[model samples]
Target chain A: MKGLTLSQRVAAKTILVIIFLFKLRNRATRKKIAFGIARIIFALSPKTRKRSINNLRIAMPDQKSDDRIRYLAVTAYQYIVFGVLENFWFEDIEYTFEMDAATKALITSGGPLSIATMHLSCYEAVPFALQKLTGRVTTLSRVPKFAAGLHSVYAKNGVCCVDKSQAGAFLALAGKMGSNGVVCLHSDHFGSDTELDFFQLQTGAPAGPAMLSAYAKTPLLIAYAVLQKDNTYIIHIETVSEFPIGQSPKAFQFAMQAIYRQFESIILQYPEQWCWFYKRWR
Target chain B: MEYNQQLKNVLSEILNIDTSNFMHSTKLLGELSELDSMSIVLLLIEIEKRFSLEIDIADLEAKHFETFGNLASFIKNPLTV
Candidate 1:
């Protein structure tokens, strides 16, 4: 707090207040609150709103109508905000797991693996639920000073939370995979490790999941959560590449492209759930 | 020294850095500006392709990539380390 700027302090305090208020309400009421506040935040932040629309138009050139794009942007922001707020009070959030028979057997076997998750609705639901099953779930999060509550929530869920800002965070994640631990990383965001074709546009994506899977000699799975009308979440986990793959730029790009393909399908299925504000197509 | 030279060649190719001075004891993560997050992954890719070795990716950590020698050692035999 001492090094924070005036606006940063205000933002942090506002988040704390939102977290506190969210704790006082049920899931249904909280979703409604989050949606309303999300709208207000969207309206107030011109830069964010503009970035969201710009990204949408770039990624979704087929959407000709401005109104439809704006609507999609707002709803996506609402879902992202709702998901972030849900992390603070995850103890009460309801979610169900969806994985195939082979994945279940593999997970139940408690073998080391890498999970690539997106920033969809309640994205952390995958790791949270996996911890309940295998008790070996590990997640890497950029936990700043203000997001300590998020760190605590993961701790409370019996998930090992590693700080991404730390020097050896990637090491910790890989080490977790080395020791039969399930490592889940959010891979939807921008990165320079691997070039990918996302939303029909060329973009750079993190190669951590694919690299870990191939280099560690483990399986790779892509998971996402869809928000339900009942305020519950349905988390879907699908294997991207389960078998061994060659370690090379070509192999990493192939694996990452496979992931981007799945992401495109999920985003198309739930247009209002994926974040559109990311500077995805640079 | 041969393995060290091979590792240096991989690093030079992936990172586009002059590795003439690179040695087994050379520091990587903090010392080299070119060995960023992306380079780290690219390094592994090239290491596997160059050596025809399937590295145990799960066994990788920061220390494994901290020094040129560390990576060479791990790639030589991860199970022993």
Candidate 2:
């Protein structure tokens, strides 16, 4: 369009490419092709690869071998690349959900919930699967300007995707929580809101999940997914807080620390699946 | 300072905005350029300390932050909500 901004114009072209990718290839073939191309990109992107390796070193200080570190970093990139590409054809993917008894009751009983998730393998699978069962899953994402149309993809999957770049995105997410909706937010990223210890290092964390759970008078839960060998995702969900956090700022900060401990363990368990490319210690 | 002015000072400090000119009807959440999810955390913490009130109540919500007046009222007496 004559009046379209540069990002909007690029977004239009990018969406066309996404649609072409979705239409021309079968799901398996698409995944294979995506993985093949991802390897090339990962190889070319040394900065990204180096960052992941360095993050892994900080997180897993015991992993001393440089060769091992690089291996872990490359595999993580593969997972990240495929996980991102799967969003283009999410509806066609397969996944299985697993929750403990407490989590089951909390999720199935169905009230307002605040789910804190990570950038693990097939991270969106948690929300995608939940939306399928509850039809109440809402997610807030910082969609890049070039991929802004991905909002419609989330809508097609029945996920109420809110762009985090917009003003009042916080209020929108909090509103959803107050309205008996399951709001899923990615919490394994560094932020300037509340300070916490992640991987034994002091870093700020997003307080949205804890704050929303307290504000909405609902339980806060953490969920994650890892892709299995058969191209199926296994989603695991667990509770981080049952009662509403009543201690205000102290309780809020405490709750985030506990969540980070859990996240550290999960990321350690699935080293090749969790995203370590972020400049987390900063 | 009155609770309202105290609240305004906290908001201005946290969001790095000039709320001295803000009226009761002035919007806080969406309209303010610096008021994002991260800054909201800082604001809530500061409000709890300065107002001596916990922001953990179920009745507290985004709508309360719709305008400066509503927030000031909520901090003064949440039971009004």
Candidate 3:
């Protein structure tokens, strides 16, 4: 999103057209068509393909055999592509919310909640679905300027998108949480200052999820929306420790590690669905 | 000394760094292993809490976080102009 040529932007717009057209088809058909488009993109984008393979190698060192890693890389691309296409018609995708009793009580307790999540299959749907249960949900996301038109549609829904580039974005997030709103943060990527052992690799992890939860004294939870073969999404929610008031540096590190641990486990389970093309460890 | 101690305490608390040895010459930003984009934000948050000043990320530059002295000056008066 940082660097995009005019042609690339036009190409993305063209893909959006195809995504819009696919919306006319049935759920299963659309998904199949989306996967087909994704496969083609996977084949064309060598950078993404290579990055995915590299990521898998780093995260899953025991996963020997190039063929398996290659397949997973391509499939990961397909998931990323399908995720983009699905966002066009996310309303059509049937979804169910699943969480433990304590997690459910924390969310429904009528207090502010902070959700730490990753860019998994249908990751955008996490907030989209959560907003159905929780009244207003604000998410920190980076939508390229090219797709501003499409993202505006998502903004029309209760899920407000805060551009990560904006100065003092955390202030907005903290304010949202202070007002008893749900703030969902995607922490899978390398966007922050703190280092954590993710997949046995020390990587810079965002301090947002922990800092926000601690500062706002909100219940922190980790969640994901996994796309099933039946064209349905199951949003699984679990508890990340609630931020104790006046969180110390040790507590912050522990919280960050806890979030990443859950993320690593989820990625291990659905390696193909997680976006692995990015330089996650760097 | 009051503001300096307060700022050091904040940096120590957020970054888990022992700031006792930190002095005016203590380098930050690229020089400090713990100071990065994420830590910068955390530092800003902590600075706001300790010093009661608002930091506009848009207005922030590398110089503001170059050294402990710079950061302390910024905290004493967060004039990003």
Where in model 1 is the C-alpha error above 4 Å?
A1-14, B1-7, B23-25, B41-60, B68-81
lDDT tens readout by residue for model 2, A1-282: 455689788877877687686668887787678778777988998889889988999988987799989888888888888897787778778888888898899998878899999999778888888999888999999876566567667988899988787666777786677567899999988887789888878888888888887766789999999888888898999998888775366788889899999999999899989887777888
List TM-scores of chain B, every candidate. Answer: 0.85, 0.87, 0.87
List the candidate numbers ranked by DockQ, top first.
1, 2, 3
How far residue B24's Cα lies from its native spot in candidate 1, in Å, is 6.5
Pairwise TM-score winner, candidates 1 and 3: 1
Q: Over 4 Å off in model 3, which ranges?
A: A1-16, A243-246, B1-81
Candidate 2's C-alpha runs over 4 A off are A1-3, B1-22, B25-27, B30-81
Ranking by TM-score: 1, 2, 3
Please, what are the lDDT tens digits per residue for candidate 3 over residues A1-282? 346688768866786777668877887887688788788887988888888888999989998899999999988887877886777777787899899899889988888888888899878888888888887798987776777655665775668888777644566676677678888888888865467899998888887777777766777889898988777889999988754434555667788888888888999999889999888877
Error of 3 at A25 (Å): 1.3
Specify the highest-TM-score model's number.
Answer: 1
TM-score of chain A of 1: 0.93
Better of 1 and 2 by TM-score: 1
Give interface RMSD (Å), model 1: 2.7
DockQ, every prediction: 0.49, 0.30, 0.12
**Candidate models: Cα lDDT each:** 0.82, 0.81, 0.78
Clashes of each: 3, 0, 1
